[model samples]
Target chain A: MEENIKFLRSGILAPIKKWGTHWSLWPVHLVTACCGAELAHAFASGYDGERIGALNYGIARQTNLIIVEGAITRKMARVLRITWEQMPDPKFVIIMGTCGLNGGVFWNSYHLVKPFEVVPVNYFIPGCPSTPEALLRGIRQLQNEIRTGEPRSSIEFEKVDLGKGKMMPVTPKSPKKISLAPSIVVNVPRKADEETKKLADEISKLGLATTVTGKNRIALRVEKDELVDAAKKLQNFGFDHVKNVNVIDVPNEDKFIVEYHLGSYSKRELMPVVLNLFTELPRSEPKLKSLAKIFPSADYMEREMHDFFGVVFEGNEWMGRKFLLAPDTPEYPLKKDFKLEEEKYLR
Target chain B: MEALVISHQKQIGDKMLEGLISGLFKIFTSNMMNIPLIEPLVDYLMQIPLVNLLVALILWRPFFAVIILPGLVGLLIYLLWIVYWERKLTARVQWRVGPIEVARPIRGAIQALADGIRYFFQEAIIHREAHKIYYIQLPILAFIPILLPLLFIPAGNVVGIKTPYGIQLIVAFIALIPLFIVAMGWASHSRFAYIGSLREAFMYFAYEIPFIIAVVAMIYVYGSGDPYVAVEKQNIPGAVLNPLAFIVYIIAMIMATSRLPFEIPEADQEIAFGPFVEYSGILFGLVMTLLYEKLYLMALLFVILFLGGWEGFYVGILGDFCAPLVLFIKTVVVISVLVIVRSVYARYRLDQAIRLGWTSYLTLSIAALILGMFVGVLV
Candidate 1:
């Protein structure tokens, strides 16, 4: 990479090369988040980034500079890298917003990726969604770097000691009351209305554990093999659709609790009531009968659950395949023991 | 007797070499440009042995037409001027100052120079999938058709190849330019390039027929295919004689050169500059200017057809060279005015531009042809 920059600076026409690159910093903007809006404002009539010779171009192959806007997610990181690689030699990258710098509001999020880790960033404009002025400043700093062989911050803040006359605040510690083997509770008993209680009694007739969880909610626990039977009986009970499919990983108990929230649009009275149907499977071989056949809406949700938790829905066609995640993402991200790589910041 | 005969043959060979050199010198001096402003300097230089030959060759009319004014050198200057002017003009239209930071003292007039230098040094990547030979060769090859038209496009007494079919030759060469562009797209082998080249071929058919008809109309109105005759007969100017043809020619110029309204083939936003999408660095810079060069050629033809060709007030100092200077200035002005359309209008869709070209635009050209025929008889 330095060889490319060196080639531009070593020739007899180096001054001309440097001058052109400095002024003609056409950015192929990779808009990942809200900072893209600020980028537009910078180039629009108000700020007019083109006045300084920084035009916004569309193609990655023809342009020299890339302005990465906001946070790059796990999926977008691949795209960012590809765009960078597609660009010709002596290309520069200026990442905008605090998200691109350190993830901003999405700090330590499982899906958020630090852009600097993917490409060599020339300048960073720090803000949640950086102001357009800061974006222009970032471009100016990059221009300055091209002219001189060194990079510097556009704005420098003075290090002030606020603790000089006041008491320094104590550093906080991590909370000590974390439960080691916390119980995974899906059915918390609550005082239900008479109608919900009567409905719970009717569901209990299927020879399963039933509890009234809330005013218009009931929880039914069935064995893994009896899940299909329970869903068929519930469909007959006017729970015509599966509203959501979720998987809870209980590492300490060595079990996976799968829940299907059932609701109805066909039956008027059952429209307001939510029936929580759950079943447990052994952690090592977490397979359960899919309710997708009984409820067509459950198909996509079941596939998504399979993507996150690696829970095999025995009869669902999309059970073993990955969905709703980038191809490069780690498998079973929602598993309790799956550890994400912690981001380390250097001083 | 045998030795004497051999010596006689050697003397004949030496005489032929001498005659060849002096004959070329006679041709150069006879047709040399008579610029009064540089007379004293040229006279002083003429006394020198070796340098005088070089000086006379440069001032020679045929060489001057091909290499100097309204030719390669003029094209280079126009390229630098127009790129910067287009950018600055668009900036002004949008209420901005535009590209003034590069050389602030000159108001960034040399911005294009800097860009050219940067592109010159940057890497030119030929992707793995590209046709390596054609991908590398096509941009340079495209310049042939572009420069060839300059040979027949006369500016008064200065012309590379004076011909009876001057207008036809120029039009034919101009038509060949799009084939190179289409070939460039075929070599790139990328999806965007494929789409871009396909659009270029479609646009070629869309505007080519009407463009030819419009030129034919002018040819009819002028009563000859020669540019000199065309200019000489235009006391009323061709535009006044055949206004419909003038309008048709202007629209054809826009469509042929891929200016904003008909910029379907290389729509940067839609298909990422189409056939040139895969090119980078110096290769991209070369491909980028192909349209502008084509525009310059077509505009020259335009001035010769509708506008009076090189018929401006003759400068006494420039003499025979005055014609090319006036012609170059007029062509530049025509293009400068044309550049305003880029910022003013939005691009038309491929289908819409094609439909307009084949239907209404073609009808207009045919009508222009009829008008030219009627006017040709009266004039």
Candidate 2:
């Protein structure tokens, strides 16, 4: 990489190469997220990024730079790496938006991957979605970096001494760190109004462990074999559809908690109720009866849950094959015990 | 006696060599260019021996025709200007400044030069799946047809390989260029390239018939395939004589070169520059300019057939050089005007372009052909 830079800087043709590359920084259009809109505006008439000779090209093979628009998830991270590899040498990367920097709102999210980790970024335009002017300014800075062999910040900050003030300095708060082992209690009993309590009491009479978890919310626990029977009884009792199917991996407890949040669109009186039917399965062989037949909307969500936690849904045809993730992604990535490569800190 | 004989043979060889040099010099000087703008410089340079030969070769009619005006040098100038002009014009239509920061004073006039330099220095990746030999060879080889047409295309008396069938030969050579493009696609061995080459092959048939008929119509109107005779016959320009052929030829030029309205083969958005998706660095620069070079060749032929082939006002001092200058300027102007279609018009779908070419465009060319036959007899 240094050799490539050296070749661009040291030869008799260096000036021409530098000048040409400086002016012709055609960024390949890799619109990963919302920041792509801002990139468009930069090149559009408002900001006119082309005035600085940064045209947005389509293919990776032909362009010299990549303006990574926003968040790069684990799946798109591979795509970002492949695109970076496909481009010819002496390429630069300008990461746009805070999601690409350190995952802004998606910070520490299971799926979010910092684009900086996937590719060597030359510049970062820090914003929720970097503005059009900031994008063009980033391009200008890249051009300047090409002209001069150094990466200099376009705007320099003026320093003022804090020690000159007499008042005590406010200490900064420590950053939040997520717990290694999270305590997940899905069926916690809670105080509820009469209607929800009556619903919970009526659900318990059907031979299932039921608790009122909140107002208008009831949690039902059933053994793996009894789940289908419980689903059928709830279906007849006005629960018409499955709002979501989720899986929680508990490595310490050595079990997978599968939950189905059921709702009713057919019955107006039952519309406000959210019945979360859950079952626990051993980690070694986590299998469950699919609720897809009882609630048809659960079909795709069941497949997604199977993809994430490797929980086999017996009646789901889409099970046993990868779904909702790229083919090369590590299997059962959402499993708590499935370790991701930790981000390294450089001091 | 042996020594004398050897010396005598040496003298004869030297005499022959000197005679050959003088004879070649005589030929070069006899048809030398008469540019009054450079008359004093040429007169001064003629006092030197080797410089005079070099200068004579540069100004010699045939050499000048092939290497300078309306040829390689003119093509280079046209490439730079047209690329920059097209981008700038498109930017204006888009309500933006295209590339002004490169050289702020010139409004980035040398933008193409910078891009060409960058392409030249960048890595030319010959991927593993490619037909290594053909992949490397095709772009350079493609220039054969491009340059060959220049040799046969005459500008008044200054010409290379001046033949009676100059127009037909040019048309034939221009037709040969697309085969190289399709071959480039085959050598690429990628999906996009495969689709792109298939589109190119379809478009080849789509436009080539009408294009040929259009040229044939002009040939019929002129009553000869020779450019000189075609020019002499055009007391009223050929466009005025056969307007239908003129329109057909212009559309054919657009389709043949894959200009915007018919830019199906390498629609960058749909197929990622289609056949050229795999190309990078200098290889891409060469292939990218291939269509532009084709445009230049077609425009030169367009000038010869319809625009009266260098029948502009003759400058007395410029002499033989004036004709090529006029031809080149006219070709460039035609191309410059044609490039606006890129910004103004959207690309046609492959099916739409082929339908237009086969049905409506074909009909127009046939109409022009019949009109040309009538005009040929009348003239």
Candidate 3:
């Protein structure tokens, strides 16, 4: 079997085999991230990867190539490995976008794994979302490599030296610390408009302090203990669903500000309204009353917050399981204390 | 007495061998494909020893029909042509050049061959859960029902086996195709394959009745199950004579082959090729072509019933061979037109397809039966 395959692979019949393999480079459709949109663009009418014989086929068994689209969160990394392992022999992997290379904008993300760690990569296409042309060019390069047995990169990196013979520093210099997180105010005081006045008047009946944060944005803060009762009042006030769950870490205050952005889907006039319910939890305990049952839509958002903030939603059964992150992912990656290895080039 | 019996047996064996040899000569001369274009070379080749037998077997009407045109050779060429043409046509409609990079000058005409070779060389994986023997056997086994129809499909003066109930036999064979597909899905033992197999069974029930009724309607119009008699009766093409049947046949054709709007069983988006989810390498390749082969057979039957099979302007040079060529060309054209369906429509939901198959197609097929009867009486 070995001898026959060798004969087909690199012996007398290698050219024929190469020709076939080149034209039949079907990539398994395993969209890992946002780059999949651009990958779709590459395969769609505008670019048409089929013209070059790289059809985006479904199922790992039928495909011979894997085009890792972009960022692979830690959870997706496991899936990526399994899919790669399932693919038949003589398979190729092409990781597209800077996210897969060094995580790009998510460079120090707590829940991300480089695709190379999951599977052996044959090529890397760099861009946040690489252009369709770049993607096709990558396939063309792969075809050439198959025919010639030469591992050629689609791009060439030219070296640039700016120091002009100056000696290297003995110790690597540290960048000035500049955090990019926006300064968030959970309760910003503002004058109420007619709509806000109506909303505030109704919310004030609940006996909770309400503030007009912005147009269609209301901030209602309550003690952690009263969160359930305040949410029940708001639920009765016609906030149909939870739009978002947010947590702001304040290490100096030794507190975690947990907020649920609620919105109305049923009441048409209240469609534009987004009511933020804010509560402060002690950093040590970091636990809150679960609002999953209060608003059915909050169940998943609550789980995601549970994954990111390590905030235990008391009644949510999924609090312990990893929903959005890999089981092995670092705890509370979004917290202020969870510093990613300090960015050497950060300014 | 024993010595006399042994001598008599030897004599009988010798005579039997002689009769077979003489029979071959008679068969060759009597039914050879009389190609006027290649008459001189044919005559010259007939005078040779071993080569003459080959020429004789190839030119013999039944053998020619079964092994040459409208059979193995025709199927092979159609398989290659359809794959490339489908991609090219879909790309054109989608506003893109397709398959041109491989063999750039010929516009990647050999793209399928390249893929076939790659599939041949790649490993055929049998996952742990798969029923190994059945998984290995099913792809090859599925071809039996598909190829069995060719024996009954008459082309001009050449036919493999001319049964009076030819159309019915072909339909019976066509129905067997879905059974093998169902078995394949069961053998695969994968979740997607299991879902795919169940969908295949549902689709089989959905489309088979309308498709059978459509064919039966055509038979009623012709007043015979024999394709040759149907072809002879068509002074007017069946498509024009009984248009309701023609329309039903076209719709049933799409549904039967699982073309777009009806590609539910092997929906890549939903079930990842359904029954073929676990197929890899050449095994995948074999199963992939199953639908195309089914489409070819259906088109052959469709042409005989509606599109005027072998009724084109006859080529004098090709003689009896011309009919099969005409039929083959018509079937190819029919299938080429089907490529538009892929780009024009998205797949329908299972419930939607079932509703259509049960309600619309079934009602139309019944209407076609009524029309065929009225047209038959008038003619």
Candidate 4:
């Protein structure tokens, strides 16, 4: 394949092909992350990527470039791969973010995946959210690479001794560290009204503990087995929608704290209130009764939680399938022990 | 006497074939291009055996009409010029310098050329799911309609084929271009392509009726469909005679060519070039330009019906070349003025364009037709 590509580029037609490819570097508009906003800026009237002959094309197949903007989560990795696979050859990829290099602000995020792992990159534009000008510079570099048949950086850097030039302060130590034993508290002490106390009293019978977390917020803690019963009673109490499902891995405690944030759209008065129905399960057997039937909106969120933490929402059907993550992605990535590769600073 | 008659008939048949070949030369050379500057050169070239035939084929009025001026060469130049102009004009309007880096001296005029070359070399991927035959054939096949109309559209005395219904035939052939686009989407076998094809079909219905009616109104006012007759009769251009039909035609033209305000079917942001979602490389380029070519064809017809076709001061030196040049310039100017919508107006939704086409354009075209009938009676 390498030889074939070289052969095609070795004749009088080489310059023509390169020139054509450079001017028509239409990037497929796949908005994967926050950097996509800057990409829009680059293409929009402010920067006008068209002035550089890099229009933001809409489809994958017709486009010759992919500006993999910012971070790729576990879920978006598969999409990135599929989109890359679909584009025609002589294609180029420009990863436009510090996150793409080593995760930037999401350096240790459970869901973040490196974009370079998904697609062969032609250029890396480094910034937290790379500026539209920086993005255009990256495109200019790609154009230069196409024209000259050699990959070259847009700017040159000369070495500067930071310590010698100025009176530099000693490097500050990172103040925060991952908690070895998190208290995992969902329910804190708070006062409750008679109506709330009555609701809590009714809910506490089906659970181990109850607390009014805040205004319009209630928390019920239950054993893994009693989760369904509590969800059913909450539905009966007019909380008809499950806002989200989340799993917190407490490796030190040898357990997983699974929480379902429930709300109501069908019942008017209950609309502002969110009830957190949570349960503790042994890490060895992190299976919980599914409340999917009681709250239909919980189904998709349950699948996502299952994907991240491997906590089985027992009655839900898609327990093992990778709904949000790529099939080849490491399993149960949100588990406390799961580690992304450490970032390497440039010398 | 029968034997003598048979020999005489054979001699006449031989003379007819000879006459036809020699007929090619008469049209090629007589009152040939009169550019005094190039007259000696043309005459010198006319003496060469094969080069003369080539020159004759090139300068031969009808042959030149289809292949050079308003046909292949004209189409090529228009494609190059319009693509650049559309981007540059849109950029200027949007407050940016458009495509100046490539051949900066000419203001990136060759940007389209470079893109074309790139597409030529780029891998034309035929996905496994596509219906291989039709997927490959449709883009090439679409050219038939786009090119077929060029034969009948007259530029003054020059026409590939003279027919009374030249205007109608051009419209008919131009309408056929959309069916192939729908076929392409079907052949692509993708979800977006399917949606795009449906939109293209909806758009076809939305515009084609009013487009025909607008043309019909013009034909009624002109009293004939022959372009020459329309041109000859237009002491006042058709736009002046039937202004409502002119409005209807321009709007329908936008919808037909899938320009900005009515560019719903191939809304690049919404459906990713619609029916052309799956096309890549050269196939993508070809499908992309299909609309521009269709626009060129309709603009040619638009000029003939409204802008006085080829009614410009005759460049006596160039002889027959003068009319096609005038018509080409008129078509280009109309298109240049028309493309301002790209930067000025946002694309309409499929339903909005349809409603506009079906209700407002239809009513105006019908009104134009009624007015045309009254005017026809007066004439």
Candidate 5:
């Protein structure tokens, strides 16, 4: 008799429970690394996140859930914290992939940070680059929480006490001088190979000064006005994509070296070419023309460089303030003479 | 003669009571009889005049069909099936197998269940800046309006309710969704929420007219305000009879539900989840359901307007219940088609989406209306 009653109640209530469980789980649009590509795939065709109610929203403030993809660098930490605090309460966090849990391959890197330390996470999905399936699972977990008003897990943190120890105030030490050669040097032939020389000659024929730094490597010192034309020439030469846009700060020289690393996704013959464009600016009021207008992909990289080096992009008036880095950090820490420890004490 | 009549009536009553008692006893003793003892207890208690009257009043045909039964079983099953289909479809397109690990044998049908269990144990994060009451109330409130359109949606002959102006009623209810979305955004009290709310408001205007116009064109051609009658008239299927209206309706459906090419308000890369940015746990879940609810309502409209609702085979069982089977099949087909489109296309830019809705879709729908009228006259 009792068993029959249980069955009857379940028959009546099960549908209600299912209905409540099906409609929730709003995923935040926070992409931390390459796993974001897979995240997009999960929400995109075939695996449409919409069917499960994991609609991807643009701003963190209005979104109640966050899917922290792979890596959350120290630079993204502040944004994560602010975004979490900005959202209305009763929000859920799904740390997608192993990188978010323990930093993955970048675990020991200085830049990577654990996402849970900054936000109260609800779900931890295990995957290198989590497939869309994993993401949907995480969302379903969130929905279950809604049906049964119970907390998924407790937020645990270890608080260390230093009150028992004696402390002494001490002057900060200067930053150690690490050899820059490791980063600067390239394993290039001292003399240009025949193919590189021919390319250099062809580049010069375009009425531009060309310097062959190494085999298959060419540098063009173009005027600010001619940078766009130089980029077009390189594109015609089959250097199809921009690999990296780097800005080198030289405070004493009152100038910054802005370089665009151009390479090719097509053409085997032009495979070895690494086109470099360098332009200098006055150090006192450093500003350079934005290349973002020419290459749409350069937009984010330029913003990143501006955040680290404080070199403003003149034509890119809309370049928002510090992207990856915190706004409170004193001076561009990457500058040669800047000391991070001293600045911390001084502030 | 009067005494004989009274005795006969009393004997009949006694026999009926005996039959009921025997039936109750059989329910408990027989192996095939799965009815529980509690059911008899409840039935005995329900014999009270007041409670029985209340039960009878609320269990009216429309309420039972729309809010009680479909809201429970039909909605849940549909959500689960649609979710599974979406994942499998997207996985095929993106070269992956989605959620197979959770339920390996069944291809992760229980994946959603596992997720729900996990969510039950998770913490809810409520922010300080939020308007405490309104923020909490909006998601719950939004659901009322979201579910309202279901009443007018005919599932074959098994409609929840029959209203004269069914199309107008459904459109009006669906139109209230954006307002609640704005309420959710505003109650969150955050910058992104503010921006997202504004976007929702803007998008609401952009798609509203075109969507309604398409519906109007169909109503004009069908010459009926009732969805059930409108669908019945489409003996050749609305899509075949009026291909132009079909295309316009499909595009308008995409815009209304904020699907790809028109997912502007909730542009994940630009504004985040928009109005739902602050929702978490169950609340977030409610916000998520809002989209599906919208989709389900839109799917119903599509079935009635183009696909021919509840117009297919009947196996002749359960009378009215079986009547809705055709409509359910049609809705499922429509949803599958909508979900499949996600794999074939990327989201259009906001400007492009608005332009398409206003210029191209609007013009096409108007042209369809004229054509429909011309055909009506010729026929």
Candidate 6:
């Protein structure tokens, strides 16, 4: 009698829970591409999904459901993983459309990455662009799942063992080939563009050494002694933001080329202007001046380049590897002879 | 006695033949004259081509005067008035100028037209993934069926098509809309499209039965399927005679057009315009027009069913056009009432909409039918 009574109670409470879940399934809006426009409409005046209690909020810290629209490229993969990690537990991911499922029309494209591999998904809604009604149905299904606490179904794939009973074959690393030629070759000329030449003449009057490479391309080879003052001069001339902080390793030349690509969003003209600053260091102790004292945004980019290229920044305390790339990746992948396939195969 | 009987029979036969010939003649003449009137105009305008096209645009001057101009211009003006009225009425019901922005001058009358123009020039982008051809075609195709319903809709005594079973014919043609909507979804070739199409199909099933039943109840009450006679029978207006049917029919009409609370297929935020996700530019313009066209048809039906067709208290100075003007005014009022519901309430969920259609609305319609039968017995 007690068992039957308990069973009856469970059944009665089940539907109540189901209805509550159905009424409150909030979907997170993570806009990626053009499909974001249609997604916006699903919540707008004509359809009005807000009546069902699905609201859009920006921060991932609060939202529980992630609606991944489509295309997650390699660069975006890092962002996706980091975002997923940032969200609190009990978060659900709803992969919308065929593209979100397996990259859809963009399948086999180099830039596309599978979202399912990055985050555990609750529901996969099938459609090139699923209708609002269909999306509602998917939401309803998700609500049903939450109430029931059903384990989601997984895709089936067979795995094969390549090495059958025998020890895995190992390959030896090929001998390293070295060239005696200097890798750090600088092309310096006195002639420059009108604006750069005027700026160069002013710098020359200040008794500063500057090399003009090409028209408008002024390479200021600032030593550690005068680095700060030179950066200040460039900053005054409207080279505000740092675009790319590059670090090149030149073992043959016994030095490292630390280049700071600077630019500014001009308020007067509403345009971006780029300027470059380069300085070389000994390869044995490759330490260069830090630009963190000048452009703040350059601080992160310089630290990132330092981590990958193994270049050192003198007086920069935050030189430790940040989370941009995986720590386990062997050597800098951007280097001339760093074969990614060989590294993976060796591993 | 034989000669007298033969003469009477001949008189009856002559009158019957004359009526048939005259009906056919009117149909042909009306249809044929429209071509000549438009052709000479088209040719004379085409001769000057570029300059004439720029200045005396065919769609602009006379054609606008005839078909589109009056309805569109009137609709634009009416939309504003209706929006204001709706806001005021709903605000009174909810107790809130509804619109206080332009209330200081024109009393917020030009608000809807301002919004319409804003939407007209708004940038509509077609996404890369959408099926390009069908995504563009559906909105334009939707207008055809919407306009077709207008042909059979009668306003007072002024009707585009006068038929024995005009109301039945209009209802039949309007029913074909869901199939076209489904076609639209399938053509767009999006998941949202498929889902929206399915929702539309489901909605059709839910509302079509009760809507047809309500119409049948009205036909039974009036003893004629002809809209003109039906309107004549409702001298006191159908709403007063059978309030139950009126309520049920209104609900069904709302469901049919996917109006507020039942607008499941095109839920904006959830499916992102659903089947029309890929549509942009002029195609989206058509889709927007399609909704107004639907509202126009329903408003016409509402005027015919509840407000007594073109029956107004006064025949204004417009004379024969007065009836049509009255009918137009009543239809516009109905449309305003219908559209104002949008700003006030949000949409209902799919399951809830279905339940409403099946249980509440279905029961209401059946009860209305029963009430009509009781009234029939008493009369």
By DockQ, who's the top model here?
2
lDDT of 3 by residue, A1-63 (tens): 888777777788777778889899999856767889988899888888998888878789988
Worst 10 residues of 6 chain A by lDDT: A338-347
lDDT of 4 at B36: 64
Expressed as tens digits, the lDDT of each residue in A1-347 for candidate 4 is 88777877787677767778888898885676799999888877788888777776668887789888777888788889999988888899999889888888888676777787778899999997999999999989998888787998887889977786565455433443457885678788698676777766766775447888777778878777777776777777788888988888888788888889988888776787788888889999888888898889999999998888888888899987999676777888778777655544332
Best by lDDT: 1
Fnat of candidates, each listed: 0.82, 0.82, 0.90, 0.79, 0.18, 0.00
Q: What is the DockQ of each candidate?
A: 0.67, 0.69, 0.63, 0.58, 0.11, 0.02
Q: What tens digits encode model 6's per-residue C-alpha lDDT throughout A150-264?
A: 7544334589666755655665565444456555655367566677667556656666666666665666676755667777877776667778888776767767777887666
Instruction: Please estimate how well model 5 matches the true structure, expressed as its whole-model Cα lDDT.
Output: 0.70
Better of 2 and 6 by DockQ: 2
Q: Which candidate is the best by TM-score?
A: 1
Q: Which ten residues in a row have the lowest lDDT in candidate 2 chain A?
A: A170-179
- Show where candidate 3 strays beyond 4 Å: A164-246, A258-306, A311-323, A342-347, B1-30
TM-score of each: 0.88, 0.85, 0.86, 0.86, 0.57, 0.45
For model 1 chain A, where is the 10-residue window of minimal lDDT?
A: A170-179
CA error at residue B150 for candidate 5, angstroms? 2.8
Compared with the true structure, what per-residue lDDT tens digits does model 6 show for residues B1-379? 9999999999999999878755654443343212243556645754663544432332332223235423455555555566456545554554332333322376545444433432333234454555667666666666666666666665543455668787788788778778877887787777887898888888888999998888877777777788888787876788887789999888877787777778888886677666555454345546645655566666677778777987886544343445556777778767766765665678898888888889988998898888877764543
CA lDDT of each prediction against the hidden true structure? 0.90, 0.89, 0.88, 0.85, 0.70, 0.64
Give the Å error, residue B90, model 1.
1.7
In candidate 2, which residue ranges exceed 4 Å CA deviation? A1-9, A158-224, A229-244, A247-286, A292-299, A315-322, A326-347, B1-16
Off by over 4 Å in 1: A1-8, A162-226, A233-243, A248-286, A335-347, B1-21
A156-193: candidate 5 lDDT, tens digit per residue: 55897656344545655556553343233222335788
